[model samples]
Target: MQIARLKTVDLHWSEDGDPDGIAVVFANSLGTDLRLWDKVIPLLPQKGLRLIRFDKRGHGLSSCPAPPYTIDALTDDTEQLLDRLRVKTCIFVGLSIGGIIAQLLASRRPELVKGLVLSNTAAKLGTADMWQERIDRIRKDGIEAMADAILERWFGEEFRRSDEAMAWRNMLTRTPVEGYIGCSEAIAANDLTASTSKLKLPVLGIGGEHDLASPPDLVRATTDLIDGSRYVEIGNAGHLPCVEQPDIYAGHLVRFFKEDLNVGAI
Candidate 1:
């Protein structure tokens, strides 16, 4: 693990494989760390690729400042990370809140983004008032109160029945309440439909068929707004499809990165 100071925040990241290969940066979901991509990373064929995974400013091992964080701050942190690492351009793969950051990065710094893979996220992630009420409760009462709720939305019924439920539950429970709430605010306020529509790069939108948080319909709708974007829904998974079905998810990603996006037409 290496730390890079960007905008007074110490960003933590882990780099793997050869530096000469194409850079592929993986961003985690809300309240999660780089560990979220553990299963999916190894399944990827690293023949000509360098993998990079990092913890967001307020999540995982990264520094957590006070609340009221904006997407611009997150995008700036990413830019600094790339600049510090000397990574010229990369294929960005982001999930949930990370997907929102990816959109912002691609829109604001298009020259640094080679391709995009967005999973389980919406262009406008404004949930109903009732959901906001729950978020408020989390802000006041703490993330523990909403742990069960988050688990239900994140994992499928079958996975919840298995021992994997406990593992995932532990992951969610360990997340700091402040970090989660700060990111929740960012997600709540994000709207990138217009920005995404203007992008002319190859994009793959992946979603879990049973994802209630960012449902397949919402994912498809977001991708539809993007010109020439492709969509895929993995079966028997929920919000965190990369964890639930890592092999299948990585297979789809490898195909996109190797065959579709690497055609040299762009």
Candidate 2:
């Protein structure tokens, strides 16, 4: 187990593959922990890569501060964690809220991130009213009430019928309420469209064909803001393509890391 004790929070983090190789940091979606990348990590060329994953301030085993967190605060937590870990430069892959963090972090500290993978996310999610409504619903009925609906948005019909779907449901419902709400508030008040449009780094935007949370067209629209960014949509998948179709997800990642960024394996 590893933890980066930052000024505001102690982040739960892990590193895999070669410790001495170039870093490939992963930031998971809301309501998920570092294990979100379990299936995708091994598929990447590990010889010259240091794959890093971590839980943000609220989710996973990390310490949750309180509700009504800001995206700036979330991005700071990630920035502090990376600085504490001495990650000078790396390819950052972020999903959902994690993607917003990536955009904000890269904009704030351009030197820290060389590449980005925005997966199933957009510069701006739903409106504040929508998020507030969801937050209120969760506050009243707990995460379990929204689990079914959220799962529906996260996975396609085929994957939802499988046994693995139950585990994802558990992961969702078991998420700390304060953490979920805190991150929800942070997301509610964020709009990365302006900042993300200014990013000049190499970017790859990935969306799931069946993703109701972040549709392929929405993801493509954000990717189009970048001068030379590329967008790919995974078929028969929803928001969490890494969980439903890791092969396709990792394939795009490996190609971006190798061909686009020229990251070589030993």
Measured over all alpha carbons after superposition, the RMSD of each candidate to the real structure, in angstroms, is: 2.1, 0.8
Name the regions of candidate 2 deviating beyond 4 angstroms. none
Encode model 2's per-residue lDDT on 146-227: one tens digit a residue. Answer: 9999999999999999999998899888889999999998888888888889999999999999999988999999999998
To one decimal, what is the Cα RMSD in angstroms of model 1 from the true structure?
A: 2.1
> Relative to the true structure, how large is the alpha-carbon lDDT of every model?
0.85, 0.91
**Model 1 C-alpha lDDT per residue in residues 152-195, reported as the tens digit of each score:** 88889889889878877777778777777777777777789899
Give the TM-scores of the predictions, in the order they appear.
0.95, 0.98
Question: What TM-score would candidate 1 get against the native?
Answer: 0.95
Cα lDDT for residue 202, model 1? 89
Instruction: Give the worst 10-residue stretch by lDDT in candidate 2.
Output: 257-266
After superposing candidate 1, which stretches have Cα over 4 Å from the reference? 128-131, 263-266
